[model samples]
Target chain A: MFTAPLVVAYPYKRTVGTLLSRFFQSLQEGRLEGTKGSDGRVYFPPAEFDPVTGRQLDEWVTLAETGTVVTWAWQSAPQPDQPLERPFAWALITLDGADVPLLHAVDAGDMARIRTGSRVKVRWADERSGGIRDIACFDLLEGAS
Target chain B: MARRDVAIVATAQRPNEVGSTLTSVELILPVINDVIAKVGIERQKIGFWCHGSCDYMSGQPFSFVAAVDAIGAWPPIVESHVEGDGALALYEAWVKIQTGECDVALVFSNGKTTSGPIDRILNLQADPYMVTPLWPGFDSLAALQARACLDAGVLSEADMAEVAARSYRDALNNPIAYAKENVTAEQLLARPYTTAPLRAHDCGVPVDGANAIILAAGDAARSLAERPAWIRGIDHRIDTQRLGARSMTESSSAAIAAAKAGVGDDRIDIAELHAPYTHQEILLRRAMNLGEGTHVNPSGGALVSNPAMAAGLARFAEAAESVFSGSADRVLAHCTSGPMLQQNLVCVMEGE
Candidate 1:
């Protein structure tokens, strides 16, 4: 006797628009810039408006790519379209010129080696197609030594 | 300036299911019309209209827009929608009423859990940049909080089972509820864990359904309800999305909302709470400051049937039902959002 198979489904798609779309467009062009919020704070991935004071963020500036990982969480299984396809570390990297921690994927697969103070570098995707996914993945800065 | 009052004059809800074989308009029309007909209020008289829903749930955007057509909104009666619960829509309408903007308003919502992997769909709500990439689905996140609470001595696994036992048993009396039963804390604990420290029963079932509530102010409200559940106060607030920044065991926003709404000193006869997770119910109970004497979840609460967008509003609707039935007078209603009780809304209802 033969049995019918059961099927299961889940969505792995996301839509990008508005402020985030503009922010990613800049990232795709190799220009990492931030807008100054009403609080006089330069927030990266420019908010539509200052979340605190509700003022428009119009001023822009480019930021250095180097940063230190503040805290890290290891993804045993990465989600679809994420920069890292296998088990890897996602860190909160505060770029040298930025005031807040920026989220990005670290190419390090072994989480036990990744720590709060571990140093990493961005490996910007060679062919930028105008999206946040353009950054692809970052690698351990072994050559930075 | 005196604080004006508003009450839930009429409420209606559909049964809970994992998936509904209905479109948004098909899902909402009957429930919306049912509430409107119950109160006999003309749709044109309604001042402001707002609803709550999430596109992430159905793998589509602006799903709530079609649900509006059931109201025949071609004339464009004032309206808006939040990516949240219909309870928040109720909160928005109440705020407008306090502003003396409109005399009557309608709030509603509907959600289908079976449209996709409901657990994974909730991941979109997490920190997309970091945490969500890890795929720590809702069950895992709740288990994380459950771990924190248990280790911190806030609640034990046994305590969670006890909550499940009570919620499921109570649901038996509720005809519209999805998961009803014959079970106890001991029996619940014996089941294997879905996530360590969290059993299947510990979480609210993902139910698909629709709900709507009618709100009238002052004289117009009195006409719809013999005992217009006057909304003495309604307030809501949100905290930073960083789950690690705040204690998961407490609902700070809900506490602030309760303080703003003046939850104390009144004889709150009944309380309807919306805590999708059992542990959240514990946190919300503390946040709302509802005394032990107050009856909570008389409609069996979310543990029995959690229909996402409609679930929260259904909570307030349940409380209003108690008021309409003359089973209780002053009532406290609560709605929650985000992981644990990160975001909260509270409303106080009173009879004439």
Candidate 2:
């Protein structure tokens, strides 16, 4: 029997392209933005091109941080590198003013607190970075089921 | 000119298991040898060699290159590798034969899931900028999709439970299946959720395994096996990788592939769906429109013995095996790759 440690590390430095450049830049500045597709649907975290028309999108639409959870799954056991260490719900939220949903975590105290249509808002990370983690996770809003 | 005829003549696989002491080449060598022996063909006669595997799962780069040692690439064999499931490689081989380039081709795949954290490693396949940064495990992403299907009334927990129950029961007869039991849907529903809305039963048990398939064209296929599973039609399609851009409840790509592959043109006796998740089985059945007449997952499907890179090809082998065994006249072998069935391959095989 042979035993050896295997470590594969390939550091990647990628440039966020034309459309996503503005989106990630806005995230770092505590603002959310989406691009309008040719079909007039706003896409948060802005896609480089319209999914339906395959047309390049340049029109940017500012979006609100607050959003409604379209659907979610409770992560009772947190895995490494997840948004949250403790239990949380992974949600697809249709942020206000965006037609499409954004996948993020909801810091609902328990699974009972979050549902399909739960109202939630983004909780920006303390140390800001131009990445998806800029929004640490979504915190469930009070007075909503 | 009419389309070239291609058929799967022989196939071999190891029993799915959680851990393995064998290296990639060691895992693959026997299956390749077994398949070649089953057909009694000389290795040099194998026109092209196509391998399907993930470098990430192997914990090393150029992993497939090392696997070629198992094939003993002498006289410089023409070979290609796909960083996906073996079903895709089978598609490539099918095309190779159609081009009149090869009369016979060998397609093989291996996945040592226990070598690494497969769930986390698969995240790298997601959108590097958006989805991958979140590091959402595949199971978590699948749970999100399952919840959407549940919320949309496309499927229910009970429906998912029933799929698992049936798969588990079916696996009892499958010697190579990793998970097998005589379980009931009610019993499965009683189990707690591993990821809410998804119990442990709902997800495929990952295992270390390898599989090999031999493909012969036209008359070459006729002389190879007593009954060769002829490839009638095969097609593969992919949906948008964006999690939010598409509908979670349905697999449009699968429906398109099934339609193009002529799944509904005639009666299907059995279907081997590469659905690792129970909800995905239901989604694929609906997408492919596989009705009550089809015996779904008689080999217990991937939910019982999912070996990542090899599972999809196993579906192909299982479906063809049924045809070769004269159990069914026509069968459908479906393979899904990426999250939420983002990519789908449909192969309709039949007996002469």
Candidate 3:
């Protein structure tokens, strides 16, 4: 059967709202931040509104670059456009001082190196941009099992 | 407010295939024709036409518009479209009938899943700012859920394998099933993980296929099929899109929808759950409080041959077929969307 590649593309500029704008700016500056929800919980990457209460949030909380993995899935074969070209674990890490977790890649080098509750810290990208990828990926903390 | 009774009178489906050379119109035409013919009704008699499909799968915008050609849109017809799943379109048709504007309606869906890199394509559905940048594959996300379930002591590798083994065995009886086997859970458990905590067998086998269902109100339904599968109760609920915001081990939205749909009101003879992953079947069963008395996924379910947009509607079709055939007294059909069963729709059906 004859076939041709269909590339679906619609390029447009997206204006990141006030909350995420601050969050992305903080990431580019090599600092972690979270938004305080209506409830006492602090959401990393800052939720514009509380997930449970649906209340708009504006209170920002500075968070540590270090965190612990809540849960993770190991990708043995990395795909294109992923954070890392090598094998890594896609983890949900609850950054210290934040109640909620952020989803990002953990460069653990090997599957055995990562686990639930594994300590990790942000590895800032050398060329910083005001985006989520500014963190590049998390690195497993040395001697912190 | 009083609600009008709606029943699924007829359904037609294409067997799941690894890949198909057929265009969306060609794929949907026969099933639409078959369903209309099965009900012994003229195409014009179908008062409303609602379709469910995804443009991401087709790699084009407004792809569903081209599919209406299969319905022969010459005389002009009342039609609608949903970007999600055909079951959601079926929901709209049900609402249309409830409004007394149309008595008979047709719902169809087609997915050319094999045309593109589906795993990579699905990443587009994630939160564009937060999650989409990483380009996480669908299987990787599912594996993450599986790992959470495993860590929380809610599921085990053995349990996941058992669901897969049972589904494969059940698929042998389904002629349209693309993947079927008689392997035991033990043999499956011995296999290596495709993604940690998830074996290849634990995931649904993706296929290219299409399906259609016809809906009619009260008297119209009675006149069409011998025993109409009455939709006694139906409800759809969604959880927070933030994957980390909610518990990955449980589906509270499914439970709420199941209760609202009265899933536990009467004993369920059979349940066709749209769980793409083996562990998700276990999770949904728990959420809905389905007991051992219910025969689950006798048609092999999405695990055997998942055709994306159509699989969910096929669950409705399969459950209705069981009721129509008199093999089951009361049945349940379920459909889920989003990452990790984030959005769920539960439908309960019964026959007199």
Question: Fraction of the real A/B interface contacts present in each candidate?
Answer: 0.02, 0.89, 0.82
Can you write out model 2's per-residue Cα lDDT over B1-352, one digit (the tens) per residue? 5789899999999999987878999999999999999999888999999999999998889989999999987887989999999999999999998889899999999999887888889998998888998888889889999999999999999999999999999999999999999999999999999999999999999999999999999899999999999888899999998899988999999999999999999999999999999999999999999999999999999999889989999999999899999999999999899988999999999999
DockQ (0 to 1) for model 3: 0.85
Prediction 1 global C-alpha lDDT: 0.76
Worst 10 residues of 2 chain A by lDDT: A1-10
Residue-by-residue lDDT tens digits, candidate 1, A27-112: 88887776666656555545556666667666776776666665455556666655668877655565656655555678786756
lDDT scores of the candidates, listed in order: 0.76, 0.92, 0.92
Query: Which pairs of residues have clashing backbones in candidate 3?
Result: none
The segments of candidate 3 whose C-alpha lies over 4 angstroms from its true place after superposition are none
TM-score of chain B of each: 0.96, 0.99, 0.99
Error of 3 at A87 (Å): 0.9
**Candidate that beats the other on TM-score, 1 or 3, i.e. the better one:** 3
Cα lDDT for residue A65, candidate 3: 87
Question: TM-scores, in order shown?
Answer: 0.75, 0.99, 0.99
Q: Model 3 TM-score?
A: 0.99
Q: What are the candidates' individual DockQ scores?
A: 0.08, 0.84, 0.85
**Tens-digit lDDT string for candidate 3 (B49-118):** 9999999899778889999889978688999999988999999899999999999999999988888888
Show the colliding residue pairs in model 1. B6-B231
At residue B48, candidate 1 shows an lDDT of 86
Ranking by TM-score: 3, 2, 1
Ranking by DockQ: 3, 2, 1
